[model samples]
Target: MKKDIEIPKVEDISVAVVKEWNDEKTEEVFNVYLINLQNKQIQNTLVTSKGYGENQSTGEKINTSVLRHFIGDLDAKDFAKIEPIIEEVFGLNNEYWVSFFQNNQMYDKKFIFLPETICDENMINVPLLNKKGVVI
Candidate 1:
């Protein structure tokens, strides 16, 4: 029965890891952002993120604490800062599960950044934010 349920596809929205100047404007910091590129607005947005991976040297499994953020509403062609990400977790799998309602319909999707996928080699000009980072 689960397969019979209709699940609408989430489109035009993206999660990006951005590199930005620190508050003092001295150094750069990495942050996560939720971008909504739809033609309409989304409400009651909830985003949860976590990181997990294996240590190459010790072969140890690693997992970070899950953080949940509630973004009340997001306007069309806009973006909201989800959280600040420490560079140490760049070697892990960063996963973000986002849920929101648009036009009275609910939408959900999982956006993930694989280990080391946030490197400079994969950086791009993220829309709306206009910053350099990897988008999922």
Candidate 2:
């Protein structure tokens, strides 16, 4: 006899730029990660920049384009329940700094927000990054 199993409802989700490192002098990139508080899962994505040049004298340069969108969804009550956990995971306060990008341009891209239908399945290489915030 098989016993019925109950699945826990997902409470909250969040995305944050975890770290940025210099891959090459002309090519720096960022590592972004998504977190599911209810499930304690993480997904990491890499992003890069366009032009390559250094500033005179100061010797600093812009290595990457801004990441416009990072978004997620969860049950309202769940969000409240895990708000502290989400903040700790992302190391963010009420106002966090994020790179901004333009919308609808060739550079514009969108992140994926797992729909209710597939929230229970693993989403790999889902093209979950874009100019706008996460897309459901």
* lDDT leader: 1
lDDT of 1 at 79: 97
Q: With candidate 1 superimposed using the best TM-score fit, by how many Å does residue 80's alpha carbon deviate from the native?
A: 0.2
**Could you give candidate 1's per-residue lDDT for residues 24-133 as a string of tens digits?**
99999999999999999999999999999999999999999999999979999999999999989999999999999988999999999998898899999999988899
Residue-wise lDDT of candidate 2 within 37-113, one digit each (tens)? Answer: 43432222222212224545676753334332334232222221111112122211122222222222112123332
> All candidates' TM-scores?
0.97, 0.20
All candidates' lDDT scores? 0.95, 0.29
Worst 10 residues of 1 by lDDT: 112-121
Off by over 4 Å in 2: 1-3, 15-26, 36-136
lDDT (Cα) of model 1:
0.95
Report clash pairs, candidate 1: none
Error of 1 at 82 (Å): 0.2
